[model samples]
Every structure is written in C-alpha cells, then in structure tokens.
Target: MTIKLLAIGKTDHTDLQSLIDDYQKRLGFYVKFEFEIIPDLKKTKNLSEDQQKQKEGELILGKLNSTDVMIVLDENGKQLDSVNFSQYLQKHMNSGIKQLVFVIGGPYGFSPEVYQKANGKLSLSKMTFSHQMIRLFMIEQLYRGFTILKNEPYHHR
Candidate 1:
C-alpha cells in the first residue's frame, strides 16, 4: 500500500526539514511514500479556533480519495509501540489497500467532520509536540517500522 503523510503547514526549520527528507528518501526503498504539506492558513487572527479547524478540515478532506483509508494523528488517539506499528502497516498492506493516508492536524486539532471521515486515530506520544517536530518524528517512525519489518539492522531491538 502507498503511504501518504498529510500535515498542515511547512517545516520552516532547516534541520527538521533535512531529517524529514532523509526519512522520506529511505522509505522509498521499502514502499511508495508521499509527504505532503498543506499550506498554512492565513488571517487566523479573525477566526475562532473552531473556525480554523473547520477550514483546515476541509483542506484535509479534499486531499483524500473516497477509497483511501484516513487516519488522523491525535494526542488522544490509540498509542502503539514500534513493533505493533509495523504490524499495523503489514496488516494494511495485506488488505490490498491502494492508499493509506495519515494526517497531522492544525494547532487546534482536527474538526468534528474530519474525525468523522477518519478510519482511525493514532498517537505518537503522550507528550505534546510541535507540529513541525511531529512531522519528522512520524516519518522516522515510519522508516523504523519498515526496517523492523524487513529485519534490517537499522532498527535494533
């Protein structure tokens, strides 16, 4: 299955963007992976938190295809270890899915409509992380999961 990571805004930090690119390149060896950044919303000063979320939700939803499996990355979502995450990937691949999309929401988190569209939710960690940082972390974890699945030395047990 092809894996797509949809995140709100760009990673402005040079260091983080470099790492994200590295992982994306590495993941290419294992599977088709796409890292897409939805441009940040402007004029947020006049919009309420819910309003921002609603707008972001629309953009997120527009990126998805009807047949795609959408999973939102939320702090309150189910937490899984590296091994289990690999198994999760394996399960999806075995199911003959064409595309699996994982989304990282904007600052206020996903709107109710976005949640309704999601097939599931996953939490990378209990502690809060900047959206930029989470982009790197998520990609690295995906690379690690693929390595673990292949018994590569890149990931040590």
Candidate 2:
C-alpha cells in the first residue's frame, strides 16, 4: 500500500523541510510514501474562514483517487501512541488498500465536505501544532512506525 501525506501550504522553514525530507527518505525503504503540498489560497485576507476552508477543501479533495482511503489530521480526532500507531499502519496494510491518504488542513481546518469524505480522523496530539510543523511530525511518525514494525533499533519501544 502507498502512504500519501497531503498538506496545505509549502514549508518555508528550511530546517523543518530538511527534517521532513530525511524522514520521507527513510520511510521509502519500508513502503511507498508521497508527500504533497497544496498551495495556500490567494487573497485569504478577503475571504471568510468558512470560504477559505471550502476552497482549500476543494483542492484537498481534488488530489484523491476514487480508491484512496483518506484520513484527516484533526485536533479532535483519535490519538494513538507510537506502538498503537504502528499497529494502525499494519491494520491498513493488511486490509489491502491501494492508497492511504492523510491530510493536514489549512489554518481554518477542514471543511464540512472534507470531513464528510474522510474515512477517519487522527490526531498527533491534543495540543495544537502549526500546519508546517505537523508535516514533519507526521512523516517522522510514519518512519518510526515502519521501524517498529520491522523490529529495528529506531524505535525504543
């Protein structure tokens, strides 16, 4: 199964992008991984929060395939520890899905339509994080999960 991460906006911080790139490369050794950035909306200062989310949601939804299982990274979603998250990844792989897509929405979060289309929601933490930072965290967790599955020394258990 291919794991794809779709997030809004580009990472402006070189340090964060470098870390994200490293993890993405590490994850490639275990499974096919794709990280896609949806460009931020233009003239956001003129649009309402709902409108921005609606527009961003359209861009997010457009990137999916019909067979993709999408999961949104939402603040109020289910939170799992490292081991449990590895199990989660294993479960999906066993299910024989084509692509597992996880999305990190814009500042206003996901639109109602986007939420409705999602197969599930997952939260990295109860505390909020910047959208850019979440990209690195998610990628690293994916790498860590794969290491755990492989019984590697990367994850300390």
Candidate 3:
C-alpha cells in the first residue's frame, strides 16, 4: 500500500524541515511514501475553536480519496512500539489497500466529521506534543519502522 502523511500547516522551522526531507527520502527506499502538508487556516483569532476545527476538517477531508484508509495520529489513539508498528504496516500492505493515509490534526484536534471518516487512530505517545513537532516525529518513526522491518542498523535494541 502507498503511505501518505497529511498534516495541517507547513513546518516553518528549517531544522525540522530538513530532517523531514531526509527521512522522507529514506522512507521512499522501502515503500511508496508521500508527505503532504495542508495549508493552515488564516485569521484564527476571529474564529471559534469549533469553527476552526470544522474548516480544517473540510480541507483534511478534501485530500482523501474514497478508497483511502485514514488513520489519525491522535493522543488518545492506540499506542504501538516500533516493532508492532512495522507489523501493523505489513498487515495493511498485505490487505491490498490502494492507499493508507495518516493525518495529524490541528492543535484543537479533530472535528466530529473527521473522526467519522477515519478508519482508525494511532498514538505515538500519551504525552502531548506540538502539532508541528509531531510531523517530524512521525516521519522519523516511519523511517525507523521500515528499518526495523529490514533489520537495518539505524535503531539499536
């Protein structure tokens, strides 16, 4: 299955962007991985939190194909270790799905509609992280997962 990461807004920090690019390039070697950023909503100071989530939900939903499986990277989601995450990916690939899309929501989190659309949710950690920082962490974890699958030297026991 093709893997795609959809996140709200750009990574403005050059350091984070560089690391994202590097891991993305390495990830491509193991699978068809795509990293996409959805533009952040503007003038959020005027909009209520719910309103912002609704708008962001629409944009997030717009990026999805009907056949795609959307898994949100959420704090309350089921947490997996590196090894299990790799097997989880293998299970999806074996199922012959066309695309697997993982989404990182805005700071306020998902709207009801977006939650309805998701096939599942995954948590990297129970601890909270900045939405921007999560982007980098997600990418790196993906890379490490692939390496673990291949018995590569990147991640030590």
Going through the candidates in the order shown, the clash numbers are 0, 0, 0
lDDT values, one for every candidate:
0.95, 0.96, 0.93
Give the per-residue lDDT digits (tens) of candidate 1, residues 27-70.
99999999999999999999999999999999999999999999
Q: Estimate each model's TM-score.
A: 0.98, 0.98, 0.97
Prediction 3 global C-alpha lDDT: 0.93
Q: For residues 1-157, what per-residue lDDT tens digits would candidate 2 score against the true structure?
A: 9999999999999999999999999999999999999998989989999999999999999999999999999999999999999999999999999999999999999999999999999999999899999999999999999999999998984
Candidate 3 error regions (>4 Å): none
Kindly indicate the candidate among 1 and 3 with the higher lDDT: 1
Clashing pairs in 2: none
Residue 131 in model 1: lDDT: 98
Q: Where is model 2 poorest over a 10-residue stretch in terms of lDDT? A: 148-157
